[model samples]
Target: MPEKIDYLKKIRELTQEYFQISLDDIPIPETELVNIEPDRADGLLVGSKEALNYQYLVQGDITPFLNKAPEGYFLIGFWGHGFNSYGFYYSRVEPNSRIFFRLPYGGAYMNNKREAIRIKNFLINFFEFKNKLKTATTFNVVESMGEGFHEIKYKDQTVKFKGSVYRQRNPEKHFQKILKSLKVPTKRHQHIIKLPSWAGKKYEDMTPKEQEEYQEHLRRKFTWEPGDLKKVGHEPLTEDEKKLVESIKKQEEDVNKE
Candidate 1:
């Protein structure tokens, strides 16, 4: 048990560094090293044994994890062979998903309009440079396993095609370098929970109606409902959102001047 805890701690640290996010923002989830393949003995009646190879993140839907995110925040995830590969994910107190982008490598499902645009531009430039540089790097040619098209859609960016596949024995190191280069410090605004002024009275002394209202308020405060998107692509920002973004930009500019 202690070993598993330590192992998860390391994984969280890696995720934070690779995703360019803070450790406090990451959520802790029940995890286990799952068996990926079962070793088979030649001409044997049963397989030799199960090999706990893959790092299993979660099974089925990743929505439950994303739903916990706060408004104006988005969740990022890496998509691998299966759904169990998305380790623990979390979001702020509110959530939104206006624009979504996924490469053969996965990306964030973002809500903030300004942030989505910035990341989209970054991804476009990154992949274009990578595609050009790939030919210079050593290539490992292998027989075709199967043919399938990779498609990505978000705003002005869209890609759909079937082509030669690239495989690497250990791609994690290379990916780590790319993420490190793009790493930028971000601050997540914190919320302080406080009871209403009226709630200062003792619970036992409160009126029946007041008690009922207090209970309702508590339920509303604690309950988290999943956010729904009318459409799963890019959407224009409202005037209010635009103003908020302008304010943020001004703050950043001020910080740079210091």
Candidate 2:
């Protein structure tokens, strides 16, 4: 119980800092009983390594909190399927429950296109994944999608998708297959950071200066360079090169005139 609370504190703090939140103006989570031996819900099993302690409570447990959340504050919920292929991946934060921003793993697409884009922008700014995020949004970032995904009523409007979403096709069947044994950053969390703890100290906690490293890391992870092979690679000529080309063209013109 204490562990889950502490974990939530760390996650919230990190997320706040990640988003450059000046104040504690965010969703307050409500949790469920999970420490009970042999938890059957498996709600807690779908998050990233850092969220292991709270996964048991993530699934259905957030409803009470959402129901009570004040308007204007977005509700965020976390829950997942199977043993966690990526253990976690990007989740669509929809505004279906006027209560809070539901971050549930099994959540459907957002219906309000404009509002969805607005919320996504805020989240992208908050998560700092704006650079690495590869969403399906075309005209609006919310509508565009990628491969391996399904189309459903995001909120009010109907959405069609050609490729299925990445999360819908996580290959790893069990956590063991996808889990990466990680080392907790320092002695601070030695006691709390146990086996299932993966992201004890990752990009989530990186300070602004430290975030540069993460930014660079993301740039490399999704590295791409502009290319136009069909169009002959055009290089701007220097003044001297430009003069030489012009002179050649002028000489050709002179010959043709003759």
CA lDDT scores, all candidates in order = 0.33, 0.32
Give lDDT tens digits, candidate 1, residues 1-258.
Answer: 453234334534654554444444433122332212313211101110111221112322223323332233332333333422222222122112211222232213323343334333433343443343232222111111122223333233334344322222333343334333434223469898986654666655678887667555543433222331132236564554344344544565689799
Structural similarity to truth (TM-score) of each candidate = 0.18, 0.22
Candidate 1, residue 188: lDDT: 62
Pairs in clash, predicted candidate 1:
70-92, 70-93, 70-94, 70-95, 71-94, 71-95
Question: After aligning candidate 1 to the native by TM-score, how far in Å is the CA of 45 from where it should be?
Answer: 32
Compared with the true structure, the alpha-carbon lDDT of candidate 1 equals 0.33
Candidate 1's C-alpha runs over 4 A off are 1-5, 27-79, 82-258
Give a tens-digit lDDT track for model 2, residues 109-150: 433333334333444343332222123231111211222322
- Local lDDT at 163 for model 2: 33
- Cα deviation in Å at residue 90, candidate 1? 5.2
Task: Tell me how far the alpha carbon of residue 49 in candidate 2 is from the true structure, in angstroms, after superposition.
Answer: 16
Residue 69 miss distance in model 2 (angstroms)? 25
lDDT of 2: 0.32
